[model samples]
Target: MPPIALFIALLLLATPLAQGETDSSRSQPVVSVDFENGVLSPDWKSEGSGNATLVPEGFGAKSLLVTLPDQGSRFVHIPLSAESVRGRRIALSAHVRGENVTRPREPWNGVKVMLKTVAPGGTDYQGLMDLYGTFNWKSCGLITTIPADVTEATLMLGIQDASGKAWFDDVSLLVLGKLRSRPASPPALLPPEKLDRRTDLPRLRGVMYGPQGREEDIRKLAEWGANLIRWQFYWYDGTFPEKRLDLALYDQWLEATMAEVDRMLPLCEQLGIRVLIDLHTPPGATESRQSAIFQKAEYQKKFLEVWEKLARHYKDKPAIWGYDLLNEPAEGSVAPGLLDWHSLADLTAHRVREIDPHRAIIVEPGPYGGWGNLPFFEPIAVPGIVYSIHMYDPLAFTHQGVLDGYPVGVEYPGMIRGVLWNKEKLREILAPVREFQKDYNVPIFVGEFSAIRWAPGDSAACYLRDCIEIFEEYGWDWAYHAFREWHGWNVEVGSVKDDTSPAPVPTTREKELRAGLSKNQSARAVNP
Candidate 1:
């Protein structure tokens, strides 16, 4: 016979007691027999012809004695049906005694008992118990889990070498009661009815400096219908590690920045203004390099640790609207090659869920705020996650004459025609978002969208008006790129170097533009 077939036959012979049946009913009787009895048949020959017997000593009254062979050991098997031990956790116990037999070359000798379950056309699960040392008689025990899919189970008792001996008795296998399954979790509750219609429209808002500038400026924003404020948190001081990355500097900045946020929270709360805490880094690394940081295990650990701390700090503060994971994560521009935007967004959103389970998370897409690879807004496993797309398309027209030299020049007259009012353009531009909203059942928020001041023929105002219109039509939320800053040409200022500060007052042209845009609030009127 082949070795595999012999192994299978041995396993069957070892476990003779059938489950859910009496011992007398079995073809092979479970009896108290001696070594000279008819238990040793020609087919049931011992491997090494060693002395073995059914004795009446080791296990209180009666037991089976097994003596090891010199060359090697062989297993004893008894046939068992497949229907016996399926889907159960079985317990096995036996009284075993190891005899002391000194060998000329080997160190020790003993017997091993194995319990195995084999499923039809599947792998076998095996459990073993080894009897070692020089014990006259000791009770040994083992517990094994029978897989839910198992069809048959086998038990084997064997000894290795010719000199060593072992005794076994009072073996028992028992079936355990079935376990109850756990209940499923309840579904997430929807946002309250009071907050259902609480939509924010896009408006020119000032990005104030920290706590001191927060109150007065935020109140001004509320009056101007600028429902949101774009805020920043730095990762380091101006001079640290020669402007290189430093762990200490990063931690210190996080501590100080969060402190400032705490101070601004109540102020924003009182003013009824929402805050978008922008997590930004200097433009140094490329998207690929930055994305690598997220892929690293160590970096992910640190990132989550920081967010957990922040979430605990602002657990129930409604003034804080969302967390902008990163600003303009692009490839090859900062870190070289594109950052894995999709993976990074998914991981960041997951981490945020672990911390503040319920907070709107704002995520931006690719290089320099381009929406080329807008992420599909799947039902965020966590509630209140928003897809943020920054629209600065036709950059040449929007960033004209800026010192950094945006690609599109101010002379390029880009007009968004077809929409009745500039605001109506909001509906057309957000056509994708409308589809996404219906598909995923999640709200859309334009985190940042605007045109440059130098764009020709009042294009900036026209774009702004249309963008706001779109936001209101869908009852979506949005934030203007800036309130009054030289970062882009979107500000209602005449010149880049002009003193367009909040208190300095607006120019005549700025006044006329604001009035015309404000009156063209057709989108808001209809949606409201």
Candidate 2:
């Protein structure tokens, strides 16, 4: 996965509500906390060192000063009850100044101001802006429209990174009663004739990680005549609000995660692109804690709850193509006496059906959900569902310099580190997926497939073309591994040189790839 900070940044970006609307109930400030009285305000609670204190002279009169130590960081937060700001547009403003806020890498010492909303069942949403450099008192604020279900709102200000001194003054929050909608109902959705059938067209192509505010990236997919996008969201990031095992925190995480999807759905609908939401569990849960979904019964049930919530949230959105239950279920890593992919998928599929029987539900079979296991897979019997498989076969060529165990100079076509590889071998490797599609009489989706850009000359395009040919021949819908997040999986960047070039090239490599992928007769069918 790409760095966690990237995902956080993506999630934090939101389209601020316009300030044109006004409401009678929003005349007064709903919440205010400034240490003007020369004492730590009782309304705010400090976390970590809790170094917040009232300084005599500051931006205004007395300001809240947080002393930053050489190691770790500190924060102060005030939790607002739901009744106070529910169904409102909140505007939080503060005067903040930072000094000597330095760090070795990202997430360095900076003063961050955030406005967060929490819903009953899960995390609704939050947005934050950061100030890093030493400067005079500057006014910073954030405006957001709280979701309907929000039960709590939080205002947080803190210093991060190695060392920094931060001062906060005149912190205030005002709630503007809910923005009025135009009172138009959404279009009615008709049920499909058959169970477990594709509602959209047959040919599907695109990439993943369509980050918030990156509609142009998704538009790029549409410009290439692709029909679908398979974006992913993590079950939990490293932050306390998300990573904690508490059900409350998990609820918050779900709300916040789905809010991101809801924010992007409109753009997708406008661009004629469908979305498949992949619940990607982070490495902290899967690797460090050894608490993957299939490993424990409790975790499995919680995973089901996540799907239930997501299905309920997106049941009516036409742009939602499907719900990919889990990114890649690792059957090999499951503990003894735990649920297998077949049983677990069955459970989640049933639960999702309770809320939405028509929205497509996607399931992937084991051995890391790769193509090798698809032939042995038994389809889960559920309506509006499809079988998903990830293809990275002939790992030597596809992964090349990306995989740690693989040696450098592992090229495609012939002799991957002197192992003699070619398109025929690649075709043989993908035969199972093709054969499986023919045997099952069910829809197959290549959820992920890519060749690292380090492959020799046009090898990346060659590999992608071969994979697309098989997908087209099998009438399968597919998405490349990624769209704009990481450059390594980006074949659109044209040719990249890892051996000679220190850094990968920008996304200039899409012309040849676009030609190869768009060559499908289906492209004309969809584009024309």
Candidate 3:
């Protein structure tokens, strides 16, 4: 056979082999370029193919390299198998490192690589492929989806600038499943044994003087279903000692008050009652002085010292539910509003716990019982601490006839009329209490709420009835202002008598009102 004829036959045979190589390059699954090694593997090609060089930093090594213009981009394309990414959420991942780069003011401007997908029918989809921002070497990823109708795709990585060299390696495309959602937490369970315990246990019922006044009438209050009692203990009054700040006077007052308290303790204990012991100071005492007492550290020190003594004295007593840290602390009277009452209360409660862990502590909100402006229950976080709110709303109904110019004159507004007095309204009034329970799981006590004397014809009684009904419905325990007549007691029909003497006149109006309302269990024991 001739030589020319043989060569021509061989060339024809190699044509199919060369076509197979072209198809194999398009079927490769991963496309990666390492500028350090200057390589494009497995028959893959680059744009500007002639100018781009494969440089070797070391022997037997190759890396695909492109010298990029300072302001323009360099592009690379690798055709992928049509079957490799059909109907999938394709995630492209790569390791990137930047070298000889100008650090931009914003890190994000450092370098960006983007992946462009060309679909089977000549449509293009572009997504952020990966980013390299002043990183020594970092693993970065991008994600894109293959169109449902497209069977083939081409992936292109385009570099933004030639000033910064970026090397990408081990690039991959994968299909991922949907992410899982986090599970929800279960609801809390109530303690079974104490489930029936009243959430609203303390409601203000009545106010009574210290042991000096109307002891007999005060004793009768429990029978009227008064669950709470507020009794004051004064330092300068006869109960302690007049014009004496000595330790002996303090001890004498503590002893005398405790003896009296001991006598009343059994009465309240038997009646399932709670008592709040209020430490009282006259309108102008060293401790009561506006600026000095609460503002100065020494005053607060003395304040806590007094409470420490009291807490130690009644440490184990349960009938005494709490101690009223102060009474009607006026604006500018105590430490400024910002002065940490919660912390002060917490310190007192801490001392109380050291002596009596069981008895709850009640601290009034600052600025003379501003119930609506009460701070959140930070102090009451201690267990057995009850938040107390004193309500004398629309004070006209409470102090309608007072000569001293109290905020509310002694005109009882006859029950807070209409649905505003109903259960939902009651709930709204106690919304903070509910929130307190939800937040810190604590109980609330309305320590003092009452109408003064001379609130006209059965108005006080009607208000009392509404308050009692609402409180009872919510299972709250409460106390009335006063069980008997004092100078401030609001029994319009009752006559005042000395502390030791019987009433000069029988309370005929009280008797008539009580008889009319005594049908229910709560009202039945009125005269008992």
Candidate 4:
């Protein structure tokens, strides 16, 4: 190890973890660059079919610039030995500039400054920031937690799958202490199966929501003909950025969330709306990635502990129809055979079943990259379980104006990238999920799906209409991505990105949704 790396390793070893410790707020500079010398140093190397050079950039200074000539990505990275950053929490940030960048097929493929760690076995982990189109110098950063077992670490900056010019300067990585200490595993609970007595699932339709004094949303949903509500019950406190996953705060918020649930149950009961207790954020689930819970056995235990507590507490709550095991399970660099998302979800569902067998257990497959997750995931063999998927397919079209650099004018039923996306396309996207239901003879639920409220040319409504039409055809329980949650997903809002407020009048997005949901006008959850 180099002198600085050796010092960091020694300092990390000398530091002791306090009780209930987490990632620290304190950070130290690890490496940085301004490229003022007008040369791309030997420490940095370029990859892919793109031009990379240190150029006179900004005012009298220099920045590393990458020009992608065609449709591909190129990166300039500083490779380092694992000792330099392994097991440490780090932030990678750079002043980045992009010009006339076209949209890429994937969300992560754009103007990028990311930290990537690779285990020798070939498992890769990254915290990425993607930008596109014309943008001046913007400071963007990503925080990543490195595993102790990593063999190589890299800080990468570039433009990907886009034809444009991007410049990077003032790039730096901050060592934010070390990874969280392994908490003691909670005792394991026995997996249970008594599905023969499971309550029959209703043909439900609703939307996912993160409720905050939005009890009135229930009435609005019922009027819209919704019989279900997937409450994104975030148990971890989010009031403080640094304390998002703090253990004490997690427990405190968990209790507070249950209290809120208690207050809403009577209203749901009266409205005949069943609540799906969706644990949106579990312990160790961070803003950077959803894979943290799968990294450590202790973290998985903490996750299961949350479910076990809820299972025992709400086992008798008739207003709650089920427990949505997790929000999105994107396991990163999962150690082979030790733990994968499928096994963990199966284990969690069965554990929840042990306490509340009557209400069905719902689980979503981890998005394992490439051809997406749903089509590849096999049905979990746990009895009394319903398979789920959250659809925002062809994100370039659906999420057009919501996130930065997302290209606009891509409408539904039109060619996107290279393929036509209509109702049949939606069917093709969900084909694997359909096969899962058919092959297993099991129920399916659309835990969440939606386009941005401001998608172009009534695209949001058109896409939603087609999705709902197909979902109903297949008898899948469906829920829009949100209801009174984020203004971006609020269908009632008009198609104006800047106007995040609720629509003064019913908009096209709401019209289509209400048309689909109107089927449930008299629908009621048979809360067993």
Error of 1 at 197 (Å): 9.3
Model 1 per-residue lDDT at 241: 27
Best by TM-score: 4
Best by lDDT: 4
Note each model's CA RMSD in angstroms: 24.9, 19.9, 28.9, 12.7
Please list the residue runs of candidate 4 whose C-alpha ends up more than 4 Å from where it truly belongs after superposition: 1-74, 77-197, 235-239, 335-338, 368-371, 522-528
Deviating ranges (above 4 Å) for candidate 3: 1-209, 213-215, 235-252, 266-273, 282-292, 331-339, 375-379, 403-434, 490-528
Per-residue lDDT for 1-528 in model 4, tens only?
Answer: 101110111123214334333223245566766666433346666678778876776522666678887988887777766786766655566677888888777657777777777663234436443367787875555544455578777778788778999887777776653332222553332221211135644568888876464666788888888888888876434455466547787777778888887888898888878888988777766432434565456667888899999999988988888888887765533423335566678788888878877887888766422224544344566777877777887777777775544667778878775567889988876776666565556677888888987667788889999999998877788888888767888887778878877779999989988888877763433333
TM-score, every prediction? 0.50, 0.58, 0.50, 0.66
Candidate 3 vs. true structure, TM-score: 0.50
Least accurate 10 contiguous residues by lDDT in model 3: 1-10
User: Considering lDDT, which of the candidate structures 1 and 4 is the better prediction for this target?
Assistant: 4
lDDT of 3 by residue, 59-133 (tens): 124333334446455555556655555544344544445665454442223344444444433343433322433
Q: Can you give the lDDT of residue 376 in candidate 1?
A: 21
Can you tell me which runs of candidate 1 are displaced by over 4 Å?
1-214, 235-241, 282-297, 331-340, 366-369, 375-379, 403-430, 485-492, 496-528
lDDT-based ranking: 4, 2, 1, 3
* lDDT values, one for every candidate: 0.48, 0.62, 0.48, 0.69
Question: What's the true lDDT of residue 414 in model 1?
Answer: 28
